[model samples]
Target: MSDSFPLQKLQNITTPFYYYDMELLERTLKTVSEEAQKHGFVVHYAIKSNANPRVLEMIRSFGLGVDCVSGFEVQRALDAGFKASGIVFAGVGKADWEIELGLDNDIACFNVESVPELEIINDLAAQRGKTANVAIRINPNVNAKTHHYITTGLKENKFGINQWDLEKVTDALNKMKNIKLEGIHFHIGSQITDLSSFQDLCVRVNEIHEWFVSQHLAPRVINVGGGLGIDYEDPDQNPIPDFEGYFKVFKEGLNLRGDQEVHFELGRSITGQAGSLITKVLYIKEGVKTKFAIVDGGMTELIRPALYQAYHKIENLSSAAPEEKYDVVGPICESSDSFGKAVSLPRTSRGDLVAVRSAGAYGEVMASQYNLRNIPASAYSDQL
Candidate 1:
């Protein structure tokens, strides 16, 4: 059912729901695994993207590890059947309990962001009488030419350790007894479409690796965190991202050490195009200059549009009469509750089925109950 909506089945279910194409998801997983394995690079699925139960289970079945940002996500990954050794926890602000939780589970590595956080993890691990494996999350200060808010590698962003403090960090690691520095992690940003950004990251990483090697610090793993972007404008044309090309960028650019392992933390590229938000048009209001196709699903169900002013190609699946322009909006009382301004679709009417495509990532996971509205349910193609 490539790009074809199951309208009859959708009509029987509730409106404003997420529809996942299991076939597409599996295809994406298989492609990523195969391509990443070509270079023997390890891939850790970033759970912050979707976190749907079935989705997580499917991803786990593919044998990909997980990258988590929060303590709950680490638990969720564990509950989803991911091994503790396969899970890598990384976040800027990790509480004491969170660090303790990771230590309790004996997680693979904690991508520590700051010197203070490093000390905390070391203390927690000491309390547990265990050595906490850690990877210093370094901010390479690379520019991922995506949205400014999503860009995280710059010096201004509060995500990773600053560049000039490598000496201090290594000094602390040498003094700490409960923390074992095993890796160096770098995550430039998210939703990055340009492969050149990754290439640039590879160059910076090589330089950074040299600094560590000069200090006789041989980091076993070099984790270049995921930020691969998907084609939001045309999901059908490219259902799966070009994993081969994406991997080749690193294979050709990165100067891999003989004893080092490369790892990635991909989220959006794997899950973005495999699902969509299916909402029924509630009203068609005529305006002075243009018309509006109001849908039951709003920013609460999928906040990317409202939060990032993002683009999701809207389709009037039930309409075949003619094409028309519309300002697709939601029922929310807020002014920024719009999905798209001046969107063109088939001549729509009330009760028409409208789909917001390329919503598999950062869509449902970030959903909120802002107006006391019930959270939207999900339906899968395999189940249907």
Candidate 2:
């Protein structure tokens, strides 16, 4: 058994549940806080990643704000004891109630994506008799070099306002009395491992900043959204991301005015390595070539693999025997409900505990009731 997990204790609990290393989470938060504070940058935990109450509480304790994509997330953050002043709402489609909720709480800013969204927010804020603070989310046209589904900064993506449309947005902003232009926002993509992608973002941001200044609408907050990835290939070797280097890229690259605040909406990098999916091998079926280690967990618990063809390290924690290749699969009825193909693990048998590593971020939050499977429970290391 791996020393990282308490196998003896885990065996007693239910199978196919999320296990979080709170200590590792705290350490990750501490490092992010310290590094962000060094450059006077604001780091907001992207709540869409993992909204676990305990996880949110620990993040709140570290003094990081939240980046919410919806009103429910904003409410969740508020319920988790995060201050309204520290919350920033950003999404392409913000419903009327969602916008009103942000306005009701006086959220820090709304990263408005298009002119229509800006107008809707203005109208809603007018009805509420409040001026809504907003940051224009600009499509920087920079490639994040990540998965095509996640790359949002490109002009072809439906995320942010194109550069040509900024003139129209500014014109609309000038006429809207209930809207306050607080800043500008940009999110290239998620799970961006290439640091040069961020550097490219910096260049585009600087150009856009100059254009806004020329129009006499200099933004106070420069929200260059986050996509720093974690080491899924070797979680134990590098549990904590290189936050120092990640922050330095922005610190050195962004041409920020003295009064401007730099903000990041980091999701995966913060919590990805701190959690894992623990399941028990239910059956070991011999296929034509390799054996199949079918576990109880499926796409209902963690869908990244089936959805994005994403990779997560699979380990057999209940055995220390000779290594062998086995196709790790889940119990979902769909044929695509697989974890990893040809996964190398110890000589495994039925009832052997298996772990899917680096699942803290999008793992539990994106779970579904597909196949009528019960939502997996979560366990924290400190409590165990």
Candidate 3:
């Protein structure tokens, strides 16, 4: 976060684009790896969050595994140099062909979400004459208390196999000789800031582990899926998440068997705050009761503001005199393509750089060419 970098760089580059702080990203990765190593837990970066090749390579330098939600993500992870033994393929509706791809690649594990998905993998493994290792993704009905769209552990969400179906799921696994139930996985949700939610998740995991033990199936692994959140309000203040508290929640709450391995699938907390959507203000339209600081970047560049109504702590980087209230908006044709309403800034002016912070996760990866708008090109700080 050099004082001169953003403002000076903004003057030379196009108005709207993604600007990455590689130094920040490297620091974040170091912090995560160090914390995760303390508990002897295996961390798999969720590639679905942000698959930028540069970001992937930087993260891969940390020697972390990858957690993939799609066949493309699996392929991307491998293409990014992640080993086959380090990829965990997880998705609710994995196609049969994708199962074959995993089997062909011999990925580390498949986080099967349903009995049918497990059966499909079993059937596929039999064709390939291989034993497929899997962990049943259980919806423990735990609430992450985050945004509704990101909340996945709820009963109604089409994320994991519910408790009521566990018996049938376990029975299906037992009947299938080729699919080995290596462990049980739980992913509550994403962008979860509350540490208490993780504690609750661990408690639930312990109870589920106990239940599995009662059924003569104590798994040697307990994967508490990652949703630890980074600070959007104050990114620099909280560069790293409370990894000590997050991992410790599982330590105090989960009942682990001897020689058991633990795992996590953290995504946002690792990269979200390290990047920003830099867009120059095109027009500062003043209204009777409100002001709109229109910028070139719209929902096309970063959809979190429109899709999730999410906050990113926008800042007028080029202004330093005083702050004023204005609605930071985008150039998209849709009325919904807005970043912030009544947002206060440093009394912004046209051509001033407006940075939408904490955008590394779903920013560039989710960019679109809607309304025939050119998808914003990206520029990393190191590249500059």
Looking at model 2, residue 65 earns an lDDT score of 93
RMSD of each: 1.0, 0.7, 1.4
Q: Which stretch of 10 consecutive residues in model 1 shows the poorest summed lDDT?
A: 1-10
Give the alpha carbon lDDT tens digit for every residue of 1-384 in model 1. Answer: 234578889888888999999999999999999999999999999999999999999999999999999999999999999999999999989999888889999899999999999999988888889999999999999999999989999988789898899899999999999989899999999988899999999999999989998999989999999999999988999899989999999999988778689999999999999889999999999999989999999999999988899999989888887788999999999999999999889889999888899999998999899999998999998998
User: How close to the true structure is residue 160 of candidate 1, measured as C-alpha lDDT?
Assistant: 88
State the C-alpha lDDT per candidate: 0.92, 0.93, 0.87
- Model 2 lDDT tens row, 97-208: 9999999999999999989999999999999899999999999999899889888899998899999998899999999999999999999999988899999999999999
TM-score of each: 0.99, 0.99, 0.97
> Which residue runs of candidate 1 sit more than 4 Å off their true CA positions?
none
Q: Which 10-residue window of candidate 3 scores lowest in summed lDDT? A: 1-10
- What's the CA error at residue 321 for candidate 2, in Å? 0.8
- Candidate 3 lDDT over 1-384, as tens digits, reads 325245776679886888888988898899888887988989999987889989999999999999999898999998999999999999998998788889999999999998888888988999889999999999998989999999999899899999999899878877998988889999999999899898888878988899999999978778888998988888767867788788878877877888899999999988898788888989989899998898989999999989999888888887886778998889888888999888878888888888888889999889998988787777788877
Model 2 RMSD to the real structure? Answer: 0.7
- C-alpha positional error of residue 53 in candidate 1 after TM-score superposition, expressed in Å: 0.3
TM-score, predicted candidate 2 vs. hidden true structure: 0.99
Candidate 1 local lDDT, residue 180: 92
